[model samples]
Target: MTASSVPSSSASPARIPRRKPRAARIGLFGVGYHVYWGQFPGLLDELLAKLAVLERRVAATGATVVNFGMVD
Candidate 1:
């Protein structure tokens, strides 16, 4: 059918309804090799310290943070 043939009301685009925002949940995980801690001094402490900084930053965003500490 030609464009002119269609009704003007039907030709207009449909509007979408706005949705409410949802709360955010953030998950954090880290991994490390067990052997490296023995070989390199302070490696474990360093990693944990970094992760702690990250956790604070993520939490600052007002989202719930679930931090799963490092695993060997």
Candidate 2:
């Protein structure tokens, strides 16, 4: 017990307070193949506009999006 008396507030180390992360239930799906949309005539509106821009970028990150569009 001799390393400069060992008494610097127990060498300072104790801080745990972090818990705020639980909002993600994303389930987007896109499978276009509806008989080739009459030989590629706008291909089913471009695959439903790219699945609505990937469901608006995954519902802007505060997720809970369930887009099951173009499921052919």
Candidate 3:
């Protein structure tokens, strides 16, 4: 089939990129984080940092992140 046959530019099979995986909501609070017994302060910081990086990667693909589940 010729290109003209396609009705719209977005008609291409691969025109749009696939969505990214939803950010894992660690806690039910919706802050995108959580805590565990015996967990140290440093560990939480690491986790938050990782979450931030994950958010950036997903955003780069032109997709919406699911949510930021956290607890107070």
User: Which one is best on TM-score?
Assistant: 1
What's model 2's overall lDDT?
0.84
Candidate 1, residue 37: how far the Cα is off, in Å: 0.6
Q: What C-alpha lDDT do the candidate models reach, one value each? A: 0.90, 0.84, 0.56
**Could you list the CA RMSD of all candidates, in the order they appear?**
5.1, 9.0, 9.5
Show model 1 residue runs off by greater than 4 Å. Answer: 1-21
Each prediction's TM-score versus the true structure: 0.68, 0.39, 0.41
| Candidate 3 lDDT over residue span 1-72, tens digit each | 898886886555755655975554332122423455245657666666677777777667766665463433
The residue pairs found clashing in candidate 1 are none
lDDT string for model 1 (1-72, tens) is 999887898466886766965568998877899999999999999999999899999999988999999989
Q: For model 1, where is the 10-residue window of minimal lDDT? A: 14-23
The digit string of per-residue lDDT tens for model 2 on 1-72 reads: 997887787566886766976678988888877788888899888888989998998898779899877787
Worst 10 residues of 3 by lDDT: 24-33
Among residues 3 or more apart in sequence or in different chains, the pairs in candidate 3 whose N, CA or C atoms overlap within 3 Å are 30-68, 30-69, 30-70, 31-68, 31-69, 31-70, 32-68, 32-69
- In model 1, how large is the Cα lDDT of residue 67? 95
